[model samples]
Target: MAQQALPVRTARLGRALGPEPTSVSGVVLLLPGGEESSVRRPSPMMATASVRALGRRLARTGRADGLVAHVVHYRYRGWNGGEAHLAQDASWAADEAVRRYGDVTVCLLGYDMGARAALRSAGHEAVNSVVALAPWLPEQDVATPAEPVRQLAGRRVLIVHGTNDERNDPELSFRLAARAKKANRDVCRFEVHSDGHALYQHRHEVHALTEDFVLGALCGRGFSRPVEDALQAPPPLGLRMPLATGFGRSLRR
Candidate 1:
């Protein structure tokens, strides 16, 4: 059955919902990046082609049952790293999703600042996993009451950053993964070589990894065998990058 985009509402929050099915397998809260000035003029989440594409993919290829997806539009457009304005919006959306869907497992997918918000908010009760794509991490020290890399201790987390990205250094994402690992948190890092922040060069790979994680979390199967094996084998546990380039570039400039 072809899934259709439908409207899912919350009393006073922003709009949410993507291709939904009759029986929802799980819920994903999708967020996009924005500037502080956007607080007065937030962008519509559903309008983002990349975000909708991911939602559609989940709706189509997820297990036997489809997934419920929500793209969040922040009440405030900016990240407000010190205050976590965006994470609060995500929390509201997650709460509404839980209220409407009942105790289902929830996954979060976000990009740039949105990724920061998702990671900050992953400690919530309903979230089981998080996928942060090209997340913007400057100096890697931004933490609000809503976040700390340690907050995600028991949840599955994936951080995919492009090595060539000039906007946000991939090293920040790596540092985040390292911090989580040091604390014994479940975390995976995929450093995409030759790609930029948008991950345009490896969008398909990003989608596959995200889909696998979401499906695994929802079905109670955990990560796939290849991922499991990789995670258990070495230093960069579950790190996915092109096999051709050996570690891509030096960790330093």
Candidate 2:
């Protein structure tokens, strides 16, 4: 007789960073980057500080509108190939948000490998939008399948990439964004000039853009001119718009 397969168990390891679930109208799930392949359980430190900071900023910006943020802690410290363990964790987080909030909208915000996971999991019923920062898109080859965009049909999508990133290829992300935009006109891509994988040079602008997109998608807030133009513009233009400096400061004015 064949041996029985044991069921895999995953832990729920994340905390809400704003209004209580019952009181919130929307959720932003933050996913941090990881390695290409590893099954080791993720440590607390594995949650990138950049992702945490962005989550806090988003929570503060959307506080009045009842938008809470949750940083999703992946079960593993890597993408784990075809298994897509990180994406599975993100999807579970989205489902958990719906279960806790009872019909509230969800936005997935992720960086690097986490961005890949966010894009992969945006098909979740609770997800209304996705923000991918320096996403790690797989190289198009016979051995690897292209990431699917059909799941993004009705959701808003934003891809922010650093031109100087040495890790993930910005061109790959641009290609994916173009494909997604073809299917869903709401998709847009922003290029952060002279920045690296961490996007530290334009961190504030990136965060601001994310806040604007997430708020607009979940709270009915209006988008800034550049964002609006990008969304409304035709291919190549919308897919290659630049992220201007002082975006966060300008928003305050």
Candidate 3:
């Protein structure tokens, strides 16, 4: 099998329709926003870029050792990161990833509007898990970047956003948190302090913390010893959910 040049994953608009299954314990595809990082990088960047970096890093880290990770790059539009655009990207990635990776527990990861798009894709593929960091879901009539927060019922969703983020306030994240809880989905939220819109802005502790969450969530239930230890003994477990939840600030999950 020829090695993939970049973190490329299977994708098609809306639904998937290809095959040549590769087996694994789980599969994750990272989707970055339609920014210059995506257009310029032989690979993508920004929130989407960060996820791609995380995907590649995780793959190199213990997370990818026993799992499958691919970074899906889609041409979503607008600064806000709306539904129509995200949905198209998610569908394409989900279909393609599922086709190639088979039914191994699947997860679509993203951040900000990219997170919104991942949820939309999850709804379509009935994806097992969704890791939406700094997901932006505003109230109705607010003309949110994404049109209705994609229903996350029966899905495992992890929502993370920064407390002092200027673009999307804590209120917006709260609105999303409440909706996820109401849906009775296996969902959790984490807030990062001293963090802004960019994940890179966060400290190494934040990255390590986030990597733990991403690994745990994607690793599925039956985790190995090193994976479990790495996940718990880090910034994620150390973070206080209440404080971050109160203001939408800590990165604990």
Candidate 4:
């Protein structure tokens, strides 16, 4: 069946909106990557094909009816290492979302460096879940003042990475997820085989996976059987360690 088109418009304070703001089932904040053009305009990373598709799908699909979606535009183009200025921007956007939605559920969706911002700011009380695509976690990086992974102790987090990524090491994302899981946070890590950091080869698949999580988290509508199977499938390569554990062996009776 064909889906109806959702209204879209630019809002004040660097936000893009979909659907009417009077009432909404949930609010989704989309954070774009740090890669910017010479003029600091909204780069392709800001509106990745997958991210844009997910926003439109949520707006039109029955599972996410009345969802309010926003893609944030950052003030600058380059990533400010350890400063987390983008995290501050995202946190402020979250506050504005809450003010507009009035006690509604909220989800943070991000790609690349934007994923870092979302992960760092998940400590906000209103965020119900976070979806990060191709997150760039540099090696040997001490946690910034933002303390990104440490903040997801009680939030739902989904990190999806591609095995063929050349720009960012997929292992870094796995390590981040492991840390989050060890903290007893609800977390899931999925690896897409034969794809790069941008995931251009399988764009639709990327969008579909993200859409399933966002809808489920916000509306309690679980993913279809096919999607569920894909998510549960074993990794294409590398070790798949358990994200949870029983009591320490020494403490066993």
lDDT of each: 0.69, 0.87, 0.55, 0.67
Candidate 1 lDDT tens digits, 1-253? 8886323433233333444577765888887776643435464643355577786677565634547776776666666556567778778877888888887888888888888878888888888888888887657234523136776878888788888999987877876777777665467777777889888877777777677677777656566554455455444655553422322122111
Give candidate 2's root-mean-square deviation (CA, Å). 2.4
Model 1 scores a TM of 0.80
Candidate 4 residue lDDT tens string, 75-102: 5554566446667778878888888778
Error of 1 at 131 (Å): 0.4
lDDT of 1: 0.69
TM-score of 3: 0.67
Which candidate number has the best TM-score?
Answer: 2
**Pick by TM-score: 2 or 3, better one:** 2
TM-score of each: 0.80, 0.94, 0.67, 0.76
Candidate 2 regions exceeding 4 Å error are 1-9, 19-22
True lDDT of residue 84, candidate 2? 91
Worst 10 residues of 1 by lDDT: 244-253
